[model samples]
Target: MALWSGRFEQGVSEGAQRFGASLPVDRAMYAQDIAGSIAHARMLGRQGILDAADVERIEKGLLNIKRQMDEGTFVWDLNDEDIHMAVESQLIRDVGAAGARLHTGRSRNDQVATDTRLYAKELLLSLVDGNDALRKVILTSARTNFGVIMPGYTHLQHAQPVLFSHHLLAYFWMLTRDHVRLVAAWRSADANPLGSAALAGTTYPLDRAYTTELLGFSHPIPNSMDAVSDRDYLLDLLYACSVSMMHLSRLCEEIITWSTTEFGFITLSDAYSTGSSIMPQKKNPDFAELTRGKTGRVYGDLMGLLTTLKSLPLAYDKDLQECKEGAIDAAGTLQDAMACVGGMVATWQVNADAMRAQASRGFTAATDVADYLARRGLPFRDAHEVVGELVLYCERRRKGLEDLTLKELRSFSPLFDDDVLEGLDPEGIARARTTYGGTGHEAVKTQLREAARQLGRDRRQASSLRGRMPNVTGD
Candidate 1:
């Protein structure tokens, strides 16, 4: 029988019961459900709807249920539809009639809404923490590899030589935006929805603000119907997760490519890699590839929730039950992916020599050389054309620009001098980029300092949130 079965004359079939139950998906919200119930009970007592003794009895029963669930002693009967009903039914059995008073001013509509908000808030905070850890790893890697030059590419062909630190910092900024998205998602959930009973306001004199304060929400939701029906917090969270996963997948694609024998740019540590089953010599980057592959799963979760919410009308609906599994799946998949990537990055080895070797080939210095010719009184367009001829001559002779002698360069343009050789070297080309935010070593140092400042601010924000939750520590 269901918890609301008093109105029905017969029980639902066992198969129907199993098919309709949300216990498997909602069980993860048990802690949130208990926390919301406790706040609701205290609000009822404060408003004189429930006696102080009943409040104490309800709190005690909820805590005991939490303990049994924590200790693996609680029986999770399939007859219970979800974690909310399961715990409430247990509370009634334990505390007799006072347990019934726990729901005096609320309905499961707003109650489950409140619980989901709490769950989303906590998950958002966890995601912020993960983003911080990843930011730190990227900033550290960038700082350590600041001077290591790599071929900056367009269309997978060398376009210029860029400092490796600059490349790494680009990803750091992408993740910083992810941290911002998590903050927005967290705020979306920072409101109490407890007093919106079913689709309308409750008749009892419940203080929604008091419950909001007890639950650490910013305020009580203003509209009764909107409060019960809103799953925007979940939508915001899933969207954030989806975008973050996309960014991570892009980084993972780079990792997979950079680690391959073809690129020879990085090596994964054993802790973050797996060996082939039959190959005698193989160290496969399974973790990075998995992060890349799981990105579509997060995308699917986002689309599934959007489809579920698109046509639904008004206040709570059974269709809303379809929302939980996708949000939970997206969050879980993203968290695991972030962890795997963070660990892989923290332990992996950067192949500086290989990166530097690729930096010099494919005319990475052609741009600097053109600029040098243009500076020496050649019209910029004309300088480009003349350098193009020099490159063509070198290609015909199976020679690089660096391989050409001072006399050979003079054949293309009379501007060539013994000093021109100084501008042609890869190291000099990288250093010649003195513009702000260029690939020069000094510019990379400036970028690193700015990155550190941003990372410090994010850490302080995360730490302040940690101070709010004494029960949670170190992710």
Candidate 2:
């Protein structure tokens, strides 16, 4: 039966009931719901709103229900409507009158808000952990392939030579920002929303602070109306997820391109690759393509929630019932994508020789050649013109700039010398950039050191935040 059956004159059709139910989406939060109930019951007893005997029965009954859920033995029914009702109705059946009294000082509005916040807080920490794992994989890849040089591109055309480590660290920094967003989202969900009752403070002298302490919220949400109405934490989480997915998509796009026969800079592991049905020679980077594809779906999850929330009035609305599924879907999607991408990165074979072979193609060393002449007292614009002519001279003969003899090089510009020829080597060209955060070998080592320190700090902070979860040791 529905929780409000006492007030309804007649029941709705089964189709309408099923359509109205949030149980399917919210069942993912059963553990949080039971924990919230236990804390609420304890708070009621402490505030003298419920006697000791009833609180005991309520706590034990909720724990029993939680066990059933944990053991995957909890029976579900469509009439339960939502997780709050599902647990409450079952608790009532398990412990009779005491279970009925458990909701005496609360409403599903505040209860759901509280449960969702708790769930969000915990989920953010897990995301932080997952993000950290990927960042570590990136750092490891950078370290393992430290001196491997590759062509860095702008506009998808070869622009310069850069270390493979430098390319990988670009992604590491992107995920570092993603970790920040996830933690910020966690803090957004840290405030407790219990004891707000429906849309107003209840007559019962409920000790909200005690419940906050029990649930490990940083503080109680100050206003009753906003407490039950707000779904901003989910927005924070969804935004974080969307941004992280975008970052993953960018990396995966590179992975997909690099794994191609044309690039051949890296090879996806057989575990992460798949073969075409018709062509035995095909080993497609399907997982990378999948991650890239899933990025759009996660973006849709964020937009779906934003659109659902755009025109709602103050306090709780049925529109808020449209909230949970998107956040849940986004989180699960992000977690799975992270796992797949992390594994793909960890096991993939880096084609260092192939990467190095193509690192200096398409006159990639042209900029350094220009720099070389500019350093030799020629006007930089003149040096640029000189190099442009030199490039044409080399192209006409079907030879590389390095392939030009000294006499041939000097014929284009007096600044052309042996050192300019020496600088044409791809590794020297990449290593010449010694500026901080540049693609230089020593600069990359500096970046890797700082990345290690940042990873340590983030790991510690995530661990501390996780420690604040209620029943961290498990109830």
Q: Candidate 2: which stretches are off by over 4 Å? A: 472-474
Best by lDDT: 2
Q: Clash pairs of candidate 1? A: none
Question: What are the clash counts of all predictions, listed in order?
Answer: 0, 0
lDDT of all predictions: 0.86, 0.91
| Cα error of candidate 1 at position 175, Å | 0.6
Instruction: Provide C-alpha RMSD values for all models, in order.
Output: 2.2, 1.2
TM-score of 1: 0.96
Candidate 2's displacement at residue 399, Å, is 1.9
lDDT of 2 by residue, 1-475 (tens): 5777898889989899878989999998999998899999989898888999999999888888888889999998778889999999999999999999999879999999998999888788889999999999999999999999999999998889999999999999999999999999999999999999998889999898998998999999999999998999999999999999999999999999999999999988999999999999999999999999999998998999999989889889989988889898899899999999999999999999898889868889998888888888888998899889988988898998878888998898877767767766789988989999999989999999999999999999999998899982155
Alpha carbon lDDT of residue 78, candidate 1? 79
As a whole number from 0 to 100, the lDDT of residue 30 in candidate 2 is: 90
Give candidate 2's root-mean-square deviation (CA, Å): 1.2
